[model samples]
Each structure stands twice: as C-alpha cells, then as structure tokens.
Target: MKSSIRRRVLLLALLPATLLALSLGYFFTLSRITDLDQALRARGLAIARHLAPACEYGVISGNNQILQRLADSALAEPDVVSVYIMDRGGNVLASNSLKQSKLAGIQPGDIPVSSQNDTVTVATRSNVLFFRMPIRQTEVQVDDFALTSTPAPAIQPVNAAPLGYVAIELSRKATMERQNEVLRSAALLTIAALIATALLALRLGREITVPIMKLASAVDKIGRGYLDVRVKLGGNDDEFRILEDGINGMVSKLHRAHDNLQEQILQATAKLSYQASHDMLTGLINRREFEVRLERALFSAQHQDREHALCYMDLDQFKIVNDSCGHVAGDELLRQLTLHLQQEVRERDTLARLGGDEFGLLLENCPQDKALELAEIMRKTVEDFRFSMGEKNFMVGVSIGIVMINHESDNVVSLLTSADAACYAAKDHGRNRVHLYQMQDSELAKRRGEMQWVNRIQLAIAENRLQLYFQQIQPLQKQEQGLHVELLLRMIDESGQCILPMAFIPAAERYHLMPMLDRWVMENSFKLCDAYIAPDSCELQTWAVNVSGASLCDAGFVQYLKSHLVDNPALARTLCIEITETAAITNLGAANTFIKELKSLGCRFALDDFGSGLSSLNYLKNLNVDYLKIDGAFIKDMADDAIDLAMVEAINKIGHQMGLLTIAEFVDSERVLLKLKEIGVDFVQGNWIHKPENAEALCKT
Candidate 1:
C-alpha cells in the first residue's frame, strides 16, 4: 500500500551525500581556477616589470632597433606571445611577436603612471594575454649596463622619470590544460565512488521492494475477488512486516465475508429484479414486465414467423368477494386461482397478473382454436372452483378473451387492446365464457377510432393546431401570491372548435402519442413564458407544463428538453415541469434524474395528480419535487366528506414536512378553497380560481 517500484526511497537515500560530494569538488575546482588566474596576473606583472627596464635604455636613446632587440628577448620567455615598447607619450616604439600580433594605439592619458613600482596593466584576447607597464628611467638604466658587470641588483631606482612603457602578450593554454587535468582526475574519482554508491543503492532497492512487490501482487489478486490472497512475510517487526500482518488479517476477514457474499449476492440481485418487474402480492410478472415480454413475442412473430396467442382474463365476481369478506379473502382467492390457472398452462407458457382481478396469458406456438379451448377451460375451472376463508365460501368466474399473435400483430398495445376489448365484449354478452378477437368486430372498430385519433394528434402537433391554456394555481392563503400556472393542452377539433384533453388525451396516452403532445405544450408554453414574463421583485413567475411518463422512458427526451433549455435561459428560469404521481412512481429513478438535471438549470418540478398511486406516499420522499398537486378526486369532495378533508390535511402536513408546497386541484368553488385554506394547503387550481385561457393571452398582458 505504500507505493509502487519507483526506487525513489533508495535514490533519495544516497542523493544528498552524492550531491554534497559533487558540489564540494565543483566549488574547489572553481577556486583553483581563480587562484590560477591570480597567479597568471602575477607572472605577467613580473614579465612586464623585467622587460620595462630593458626598454628604457632604448626609449631614451631613440633607437628602434635596440628596442626591437629588447622586445625580442622578452618574447623568448615562457608563455610570452608578443612584446611592445611605448614612450611616455603612449606611442608604440617597438614590438615583436611570433604570430604577428597587432596592438591598438595607446595614448598618454591611457597609460596611468606611478613612482615606486611600475603600474602593471593586464588584458587578454584570443587566449593571448597582454601586460603593459610604464618604462621608467631610474638610476641611469643600461648606460651603466656595460660598466656594471656586477649584476646591478635587478634595476632598483633611486629617482625615476617616466621614459616609456613595455607590453607583453602571453597565451594561457598550459595553465588551462593543468586545471583540466585536475578536474578530470576529480571526475574520475567521483564517478568511481558514485558507481559504488549506485550499486549499493540498487541492492538496497531490491531488498526494500521485494515485500512491496508481493503485496502489490496480492492486491492484484484481491482486486479480482481472490480474497484468500495473503502476504507470506516473516515476523521482523519492521513496518513492511507490520503492513503484511495487517493485510493478512484484512484478507482473512474479507475471505469469510466473500464466502457468505458469494452465496447471498445472486439471491439479492434476483430479489431486486423481481421487485422491479413483478407484483409483490402475486408471484406473476407485473404490467411493465408483461408488456416487455409481449413486445419481444411480437418481434419473434414478425421476424421468425412464430405463432403465439394472448389471453386476456378478468375475474367476473372477484370484487363481490373482496367487498363481502374483506381484502384478505380476495387476496386468498386470487392466489388460489393463480395456482389453478398456472397449472392449466404448459411450462413454456407465461401466466402474468396484470393488476387487480385481471391476468394475462401468453401461449407460445399454440393454434388459434387450441388457445380459445384453453381459455374456455380456465373460465370453466374458475366458474366451478369456490374459495374458502374460515368457513366463508366465495365463488368467482373469469371472462376469457383469446387473440392470435401473428406478423400482423405489430405492437404490444394493439394486441393487448384488441384482446382486452374482446374480453370486455365477452363480459357484455355473458358472465363466464371465452371469446375470440376479430378484426371486423365492433370492439376492433372502437380500437380503430383510437387509432384515428393517433393520426389526428400527430397532425395537430406538426401543424401547430395545438393550443396552450394556463390554469392558475392560487395560494389558498390570501397573503400569498398565486404567481404559478399549470399549462393545459387543447386541440382543434374537426369542427375547428377548441376541445379539452378528455376528447383526445386518452387515445394519445393509449397509443404512446402523449410524449409528442406533451412536447408541443411545453415548447409553446415556454415560448409564451419568454414573451410574457420577466423575473422581478414583484413576482417569481413560473409556468408548469406536464411531462408524460412515456417521455421519461425515452433516453433522448431529457436531452431534447435540455437542448431547448440550453438555448432559452428565460424559459429555463421561469418554467416548471409537472409529472403525474403515477408517471413519476412508474419511472422513479429516471424521474429523479430528470428533475435534478432540469432543476439545476433553474427549472422546478411539480408532482401532479398526487396521491393517485397505492405507493404514492412512498415515492414522494424520493421524488425531490417542488410542488405536490393533490389528486382532484380527494380535493373535489373534501368540503362535503370528513375522510377527504382529513386526507387533504394529512397530505398538506406531510408535504410541508418534506419542504414541498401542496396544491389542491379541482377547487372549483369558494367553499372548497375555504376548506383548503383551513388545512394549510399552499396552492389551489380550479375554474373558480381562474378559468383556462390561451397561453398567447399572457403576451397581451
């Protein structure tokens, strides 16, 4: 767990000492180079001091040849490349060089003169060194040169006069070469020591990383579910050894957990799936699962030319027993009937409870007549059987409708609708019998009417024949402003008159066309909102547009809504999205995600038709909604009914507890509004509050 194999610990261990040694040697070599520079300057000064006195005799005599001969002698010294004699006026008198060096003109002010020691000037160019010194005639110079064969004590002057100057140029190649040699030796020694250190470091790295490598390998194994992996390390009492002990202990615990986990995970995963797709009270698949399988069967029939039959079964008198003997007896009757019905079908066939007293049967590879015969048998069996609950006997019958599945069965809805109509038709004629669905039948003609509405709805959406109307959601408290509005969609009928959703919404929803209609209402409502409203201190305006559950099921619909929201900030800020409690409950996870994504853009969500589902209260906690629109059925009669009033009060209290605003729908009278206000309901919607008006009317305001 500490780290992977970078060997940084080993490298860091030796790094400081290596750097100290390198830095010490580097700085020492630099100091030696500086000392050599000073020594070269001293050597040049000595050479110039020696040559100046010799040139003094020549300068005083005004003889160029004598000066040249003296310069030539100076050039013969070690490292001397050029020699020059200049008068006190700073004019070059004589010069000698092995490589023909040119010296720049010197003037009187350029050469600074001094008395006791000849001032030395040093200049270097192109690796050649120049040293200039003033030539002073002191103690008579070389006039006594021939007279004093007795050495002359290196030209000590008693009184010196400025005669001329002498300059010498020397190369520093030899000194530089010596410095390079020393540096090379030091580098060689350092390299040898570093090699020894690096070898020691590598060996130490191997010793340090060996146990870590084992731990890493064990971690890899554990990541792949091999929890039995453990570190086989010794008891050294070191940190790595302690880590090994900890890892081994963790592995032992995980191994026990993994064994139990392996046994339970599969069952837990199955339970989750079953809860999502099946009714808990019955062992049969729910509507969503049944539709999913039906869609699959239709695809099979279309592609592979397979034959199947769908039987729609509705219990004739199950509600009678449920009302007389209570829900427990009704549940017992359904469970007992499910067992008998399940036994009547083959192992390959699927028997599903489609809610309430209704069930669905899918018979694969069965002929039309055979499916009908099987349906009759189920009907007769249900008619003959009597359910017993603690000495109370109950009888129930089932109406069976069988429809053949073929390539012509295009979708699950069409097949289910046709089968359902046939079952209802059977019940209309008689209580307990099997009926077959026919295309030319009156039941099928009614389905045709719904299908015709599908085309008209599509036309209405595309042609903008759809109109938006806003019904005000008023705060029951007079102090509170009712700035919020819910958008209602209206379609132009064949007679060119405005028609309510009741005329076309059922067909639209039944045929999966609500998504399109919902989109139309939302788009136009936002357009109207952008045109009409501006957010200000006086109001925080919001227009609520209903989002269909079908739209949430579409993975692309959220993105589609987001595309519009991204382009229109005003609409995103002022619009509120409303979804039915049933729709939100049906797609709970997706609804939560949808609300969150849009809410982040400054949009709000209202749970409309609230308290409609059996599990409505359970969903409200997880929905993260802004408004709870109480179901109209409870609110419409709340003023007359005590139970309805109590229910409204309870919902209002719960909504407030969850930080939600409660809106009561269908509050068409002042009496209902008074009751709602007493119950602390936040908002109300009804014709009495504000009649639905065209969304375009907002633009006029």
Candidate 2:
C-alpha cells in the first residue's frame, strides 16, 4: 500500500513537471518569433519610408544616377531582398540590380500603396514580404519643370504622380527559418534537461531504496530464525539516517526478544524434562529415566568392548528415619545424603533414584575393584554426612551392591536385577555395607553367562556366526495340529560352541547389548525363514525373536529391522518381534512408537514375560501386541503352586479378552503342559516338550 502511494506520487510529480517544461518552451519560442516578426516589420517600414522619397525625387527628374544611388542605399538593409523604382506608366526606372528584368511583368501599380500616412504597403509573395511606400509631396520636393522648361514654375513632375513606389521585398522565409532553428535548439535543451533530471531521480531513488532493501532483507532473515543478521549502514544523511536509526532500534529489540525467547524455551524444556525424569523429593533421576540412561551407557560400553560397573544403593533403616524424624525430615535427610553422594562420586558416574529410598549409580569405564572403591567412598559419604531439619541433626547410611559388567551380560535389566540382588545380599550381611557381584554364586553365574552370551550374540551378528535354532511348539490337544516353531538365536563362539541366549541373555541385557543382539536375531531369523523354511509344510509358521528393553526403546533399530526385511521381503510377514511388558513399560514413549512403526511395515510384536512387570495392563493396551508370553516363573510352578496356577489362568483369561494369543514358557513337565492346555494357553515351550535345538533338528520333527 505504501509503495503504491509512492509510485502515484512519483508519477504526479514527474508528469506535470515534464509537460509544464515542454509547454513553457513552446510558448517562449512562439513569443520570441512574434517579437522578431514585429521588429523586422518595423525595420522594413522605416527602410521603405527612407527609400520612397529618394525614388520619387530621383526618378521624376529622369536622374538615373540619383535613382540608382538611392536604390543601392535602400538595398543595404539586412532584411531587404531587393529595391525597385518605376514610372507612372509602369516602366521600370531604377533598381538595385539587373535582376529587375526578372520582374518584367510587374509594373509600379502591382504593389499596393499604403493607406496610412507614414506606413509602407506590405505585400507577401511566397515567404517574402514586399514593403511599398508612396513618396508624398511633403517627403519628396521635385522641380516644377524639367531642365528644358527653364521657368521651373512650381511645375508638377510630368508623367509622374507619385513618381514610382519604393518597394522593399523582405524574405519571411529567413525570419521563420531562424525562429525554427531557435525552437529546435530549445527542444534539444529540454530533452537533455529531462534526461539529466531522470538520471538524478534514479540515483536518488537508489540511494534511498538500496539501504532500505538491505534492511528489509535483514529483518526477513531475522524473522526466519537467523538472529545473527546485521545490516551495514550506508553513507546517507537524509531519511536514510532516520531509517538507519529506526532499523538499529528494531534490531536491538529483536535481538533482545530472540534471546529472551530462546532462554524461555530452554528453561521450560529443561523444567519439563526434569519433571518427567527426576524424583521430586531427592532431585535424582527416577527409575524409568535411570533405566534408560543405564541402558544407553551399557550399550556404549558393550559396543566399545569396554568394562563398566553398576552399583545399586538402598538406605538402611530408612523407614526408621521416617519413623523417628517424620517423613519430612526423612525427605530432607535423603536430600542431604544425595548431595553427599554427588560430592563423593566422580563426574563420569551417574547417580539415580530407583524409587523409594533406593538409588543406583552407573560407573562407566571402571573395573570391579575401582567400582568397589567408589562404592566404599559413597557408603562412607552417606554414613558421615550430617542431615539437619530445622536445627535438628540426624545421620543416615546406605547399603551398596556392585555389579561389574563384561561382554557376557544379557541386558540392562539383568545387570540391574543382579546389582539389586547383590544390594539385598549386602543388607542381609549387615546394614551400611557394600557387596560386589561374584560370578561364583549360582544366580550370579547364570546372570554372568547371560551377559557373556550377549557379547557372543553381538559377535555372531558381526561375524555372521548367529544361526537360527527353531523349536517345535506342539499342540497338546491334537497331535496333527502341525508344528509351530519358536525361533531361537544360537551364537557360535570362538570355540565353536552353540551358545544359547539363556546362557548370555541376562548378561547381554546387563551390559546393554540387547538391542544389537535382538537385531542380529531378527536379521538371521528372517534370513533363515526366507532361505530354508518350506512354505507348504505347516504353512512355515511365523518365527518370533525376543526383543529386549533397549531394542524396544531404540528408534533406529526399527529402521534396521525394516532394512533387513527389505533385503528379504519374503520373510517380513513370517517374522515376529517379542518384547516383555517390562521392556515396553520402561520407555513407553519410545517403545510404543517403535512398535507402531514396525507394525506398519507388516512386522508383528508380542508381549513376552507379560505378567512380570508392574504395568502389564497398561502395556497391553498401549503396545497392541499380538501375543502374550506367560512368565516362566508362573508356568514352571503352575502344577504345584496354586498361586502360579491362578496367575497363569488370569493371564490366559486376560490375553483372550484382549484378543491376544497366550504362550507359556518353561512348561517343563507333562502335568504343566496339561495344566497350560486346560488354562487355554495358545502355545507352550519347555524341556518336557522339546528344548531349543538346532534348526536341522527341529526340521526333522
């Protein structure tokens, strides 16, 4: 709108100025021509008056010498083309030149005589004006008689009334041509002036618009999110000066606003993130966030083949602190204890709250002994740290459980559970003490084997040492129900031993190798389904590979799985991914998104170890899994333990209600199988049916 106004103003200003200049030039030229014509007429009339007396007197006496002299003098005028004299009889008497013969048909009466007293008769021919004047008796005194009359008695000149007229032919063509030459020069001057004015206007407009355009562009860039843009002020002192000042002001304000907005966004995001991940009371990472960080750290450690340790801490007699000092004081004491722990720990370690009064620390790139030393430092720090609540001081101490991670840990969960178990062991031995995980213990050894198996699984993936081992999940109801094989991952180690996941899964998880291991299993299982499985036999039952918490949380791992399927498109529909309820609940956001993404690609998900976690119902609704694996603990004791039987029955009932297939693990006895069948489990797996074996062995079945 403003630009339109400027354009309108410019047109208004330039148009009238141009037209007025041209009109003034035309009028000025016309006025000068009129004045020049009047001046030429005045001069022509004066010359004709002066020459008329000479013609009348000189010609009446028949004095050719005098007439010629008079004509010569009259022709001396600049505008006079010619002068001539003639007798009353219309005979030429005298002339300025011999060209009078060209006027043979012209007589003295041909020129009109002036009616006014002193005026000349002006006649025009072609572009020339003839000024003819009659010499009166007053202007010309002639002798009364000719020389032959002798008496000269007041004799009127014979054969001469006015003698002859004096005629001066002035060329109007020269006067008009001179006027045109002046007009042409004026027109050229006006054109040059207009061109110069236009150039000046253009230069001025550029000086104004160029800097303004630069400032406008800068403002646009800043609006688009570039806060660093600044304009260079050009050299101008008019409105450009004002514009520079205004733009500088706006830029300063924008910079401030940008900084303030950036700070506000950062603060808000940090606050929300902290609220989501940290314990409100202790200001430590919550269980969910801790697990995520631990998983990431473990994965990094495992991938680099580096050793790290996890320490789980629980405050001893924390209930006593709450009981004695009230919960408020207890909370303050926890805060104080956390501060002390942070002070004592190294910057590289992560200290997190695992719920209640429990805390966990991740010691990255640390060996067992070093982890122990750090744990001792933390223990002593808690024991010695003084807590105060409104002038009342108290003391609190924590028990520590340390688990050193190697290549053999199954997953992060196993490490956490192992460390938790070790923490319980510390509590059993005595409060305010530390305990390290020893592989010699049967449970710890099993966990260690699981961790080692995860490494072997990862190695198998990189070296192509992972082979698919399928086991028949036979139906107890009907023998001819056809074979449904549960796909298992077996890693061929350096020693050529086919290592089972049970031997290394817990370790893989403990050391954060699960996602890599799960990916390997998925790739190899799908590859085998494409290569070996016969489509006609048993419909080549879909194969399920277990996915760990880390794998479920991994956003990129889903893409990896998709890429594998793209490489083997035929196996994509036949493959299934198995995840535990605990894994799904640990990072619900990531897990749910990953599951949905894979599901879109024709891959399926099952909730393995369904009833083991706290949020089973929540995951079941959120994850939309196709199958639920009844935890082995409940299935192993289903025949003997009524609680186990009831739990299994409840899971099966819920699974069916949710339209999910139920698979029971660790169905080690016929009685267990019979019970699972009665409980309506959709699938069964255990030593009683058939242990996990090589694919070749399962194919023979």
Candidate 3:
C-alpha cells in the first residue's frame, strides 16, 4: 500500500490546532462579552424600575432628598454611569452620576428610547445603555393587615397615571477589556501553530520531492537513449520503489531490442550491398559493377605500367534458342554458359554479364598472347557446351573481341567501343571465333560511322531538320480515287545538304529510333494537309505516309494518332498510313490493332513493299488493308526479267482477289508502267510516273 501524502501532511502541519484556537477563542470571547453587556443592561433596567417606584412617592410629595438617595444607590452598582429621577413637569428632581457635568441639564424624560418593554424603555449608543421606566401609579389590591377593617377601605382606588420617570446609563468598558485580552491570546496561539506547521511542511516536502526529482532525472537519461540508467530509490512498500522496478525492467527490455535491431540492420546492409553490384540471375557482377572495375583496370594500366585485356563476348544463335524454346530455355542456357566460361577463366579475371547475351571479361596483368589464349579457351568452352531443357538440347557459341590494355590505351569508352567493334567483326567473319581489336579495321570504321550517324539523326530531329518529299502514285485504272501520293523522308544535315533516306534510315532502324521518326512524319504530315488541302475541297486527295514496325508495336503511337484525329478528325480522311509487308507480319497483332483503330478514323492503310516476305499471301489474308504496294525489287526488274515479271503479275492478281488495290513501286520506265497497267495494277509510283518533288511545293500551289 502507498503511504498517503494527505495523511502525512496533516499530521506534520497540525492545521487543526490553529483553527481550533481561532474558532473556540473567538466564540468564547464573544459569549463572555455578550454576557457582560447583557448583565449591564439587566442591572440598568432593575435600577431604573426600582428608582421609578421609589421616586414616584418622593416626586408626588416633592421630596428631593429621598429621590437623591435612591439615584445614588442605583449609580453605586457596577458599570452604572448615571441615574436620573424626573417629575411629570420634565424637571430633574434628583440625579446621581459619576461625572456630574456629563449629566447636568440633561432631560432623560425627553430622550427617545430605542425600545419600549411595557413601562420600561431601553436605548444603547456609544457602548452605553440607557434604561427608562415610567412611574405610573396603579390600583393597589391588598388584604387588610389589622382587624379586617373592611378590606382597608378597598385599598383606596389609586389613579393610573405616570407621575415621573427614572433613567439609568451603563458603561461597556469592562466587557471590551476582557474581549481584547481574549483576542490577544488567540493571536499568539495562531502564530505558534503557523510556525510549527511551516517547519513541518518543509521537512515533508523534502522527503517527497527529493525521491521524485531523482526518479525524474533517471527517466530523462533513459529518454535520451541511456538505456542503462535505472532509478535507485530508498523506500519500503512505497509506490516510488514499485515505479523504479518497472522503469528498470522496461529499460532492460529496450536495451535487448536495440541490440537485436542493430544486428538486423548490419545483416540487411550486407545483403543489399551484394544485390546492388551483382546480378541475381547468374551470381555474376552486373554491367555497372563491371564498369567500375574496368575503370580501375584502366587506371592501373595507364599509370602503373600494368597490362590488362578486356574481352567483350556476345553469344551467337542466342535468338534462335529464345525463339524456339521461349525465354526460359534462353535464360537457362545463359546460366550454363556462364558456368562454362567461369571454369575456363582465371581466378584473377573479372567476369561480368554486361547485358542480354553480352558478357565482359577483364584479365588484369596479362600479356596479349596469354589474353588471346584465354579468350580462345572461353570461346571453345561455350561452343562445346550443350544446354539441355527436357527433351530439347541446344548448342550455342560466343564471339570474343579482345582489346589489349596498356599505357597506350585510350579511356574506358574507347576501349569498350573497340572491344564491341571487334566482337561484331568476329560474328561477321564467322561465329564461334575470336578477333583482336585493330584501330584501322574497316568494320570498326563503319561501326564508328554508324554511331556518328545515330548522334546526327538525334540532333537533326531535335532541330527539326527532316524534310518531306512527295512521289505521285499514279492510278493506272483511272478510278474515282482523286489523287494519291506517297511521302518520302529526307534529312537536312548540319551543312544544309539533303541526305537521302538510305543513308540514315538503316541506322535509325538498327537503333530502334524509327518510332520517333514515324511520330515526326505523322505530326508534320497532318499539319501540311491542314494548311494546303481543305477536306471538303479535295476529299479524295490521299497522302500516304510510311509507318515503321517499331511504331506499330508502340501503344503510344496509336494514342498520338487518336489525339491528333480528335482535334481535326477530317485529316484522317486525307491521310493514308503505309506499313511495310515485313513489319506488318513481324508485329502482326500490334499492326492489325494499329491498322484497325486508325482505319476506323477514316484513315487508309497500304501494305508497302508487298510480296517481300516468304508467306506474304498467307499473312495478307489476316491483315486488314486497303492497298498493297508491290515490292520494288520485283517491279523494277519486271520489264527485263521473266521471273520478276511473273512475281509482279502474281502479286497484283492476289491483291485484287483480296479486294485490295495494288500499287507498283520502282516503275522507272514507261514500259514498266504500261506493263503495270496491262497487269491491272491500280497504281504505279516511280520516277517515270512522276519525279519526286518537295512537299512544300504543294503549299505554294
């Protein structure tokens, strides 16, 4: 049980002592004082009554001596200041007073009394009480004392009239003196009690507050992460002791939890560090980690007179496995190939998976010949390794490109580029081979040129330097399809010279940049149509713009077209979107979805370079298209070669059977045009039909 602070404070302070003294002394003093005043008043009234009766006879008889003796007797009692006996004519017949001057000429009969008690009136002022009694004669009823003399003549009927008055004054000095003495004793008792209470209160507060303040200091330390702090309090069976035990227990638990959390944090940090630098798939360092180590290797080779070799390895026939057995088999094959390469490489070499089907090896402190030997061994290991998934077994090979690193080596970028160029050269020459990087290799120069073209193409697109040209798709049948023109893309170099599409288009497609180019063409073509041709004025003038396979697969391109048509829906009618035959078949689902969505917006689709694929007719049946432009390879030579002529005639017939209009491209001569018309091809587009012209010419017209 906890000790009560209320009980302890009351016992020590003893407040009831002061309160009892104040209350009892006050009431006791007041009672005594009241009794003294009442006694004075009672005495005054008794004197007045006695004097009145005694003065009545003297007043009637006009005897001043008897009245004076009676007044003097009344004044003699304690606290009686003055006594007066007056006659009916308001004359002071006799008076006795302690202070004669105080009573001289004072008419007690004229004084208004505050209260009337029958024949007596009492008035008190200034600690003095006045008592007045009227001396009225009453009829006396008395038995005869002698010889029964006939009731003593019936005691003679006395007149009931006031003959005179008697008044007495009393003093309150003695009562006031006793009350003051009682108050002084009460004040002394209160002061003594207060001094004792204050001393006791100080001791009690020290006992309680010291323990509480000590506990508070310990708790503050615990709050500041000092888990070892514990409250040490000295008390038996008290709340402070119980509270101290609870705090110690809680801190102990918190210390253990904090230690456990610290260990867990360290373990998690190590795991995350490993995951950040290594690939989870093959347990090998990833490209970022590989590049960091390569940077170090380059520094050592440049400054420390060390020789290192970097080999960029690309797996050949990787796509065949992915295409044949899906990505699962491809992944398993890569894992197995990683193990095989690891077994052939030295422990000092750093092997990393650069990206999909590409791996990089850094052989530090190695000669060129030893690097070559090691590269060949790794190539042969991968070439001979067979990855088996269930009943299917696959053999894949790797092409190795080795760039020797020495003090003469360039930076990381140059070394990586040279390695990659050499790897490409090995694949180009023959698969499962090793090639050393050389500065003057023609393949490396070509690769570098293509890289330069990639940058140039990006810059050209940023600067809006791509131009559009139009070639007329002349209709051989002369139908109601007003006019159709195919738009061609050309690039304006930094020198402002127009570069043909063949120069940059292959590079753009190789780098998956065709989608950006396609969007640019579509946006500008709509703008050109809006400015030059009104929808109502030339409703049937269709402008055909080519869209690439990458653009067809991209869902964003579909939304781009939708948003533009939503703003100007009529432009869809004037635009014809052309897609190559191979691109359509490669991404058949996305292409079909793309074609259907745009075709619903009044846009027409033409299968460009038709009959280019092996199964063109089979794929064509599934594609929803309005036109098929025969592959120019067949059309350009159909005039001279029989096989080309037969191919063109067969494609035109098949297109018509499928209810699609056929257009022949590369119709360079009039003979080819006449042959296309005879073959029932709906359109012929080439220099012979109409030389290509700048699209801006249409705006001028």
TM-score of each: 0.42, 0.42, 0.79
Q: Which structure is stronger by TM-score: 1 or 3?
A: 3
Candidate 1 local lDDT, residue 420: 86
Q: What is the lDDT of candidate 3?
A: 0.83
lDDT for each candidate structure:
0.81, 0.75, 0.83
lDDT of 3 by residue, 1-701 (tens): 12455456656556665566567767876786678777777777777777777776788788899989998888788888888787766678888888753445656545667765567888767777778787776566665565654644343325666787787878878767766776777667667767777667667756776676777778788889998887787777478788888888898999999999989999999989998899888889999999899999999989999999999999999998999899998988888788878887798999999989999999999999999999988988887899887898888889999999999988999999899989988998987899998788898787777778899999999998998898878778876646677889999999999999989988888778898899899888887887876656655477889999999988988998998887777778778888999999999999999988998889889999888789888899999999989999998888899999999989888888889998888889988888888989988888988888888776543
The TM-score leader among the candidates is 3
lDDT of 2 by residue, 489-568 (tens): 77788988876666666667667877776767666665566556754564755667777778766768878887777665
TM-score of 2: 0.42
Q: Name model 3 segments beyond 4 Å from true.
A: 1-140, 143-198, 314-337, 355-357, 390-394, 417-435, 449-472, 479-483, 487-503, 523-533, 538-540, 559-569, 633-650, 666-680, 686-700
| Worst lDDT 10-window in candidate 1 | 109-118
Candidate 1 all-Cα RMSD: 18.5
Q: TM-score-based ranking, best first? A: 3, 2, 1
For model 3, the run of ten residues with the poorest summed lDDT: 149-158
- Once model 3 is optimally superposed onto the true structure by TM-score, how far is the C-alpha of residue 381 displaced, in angstroms? 2.3
The whole-model C-alpha lDDT of candidate 1 against the native structure comes to 0.81
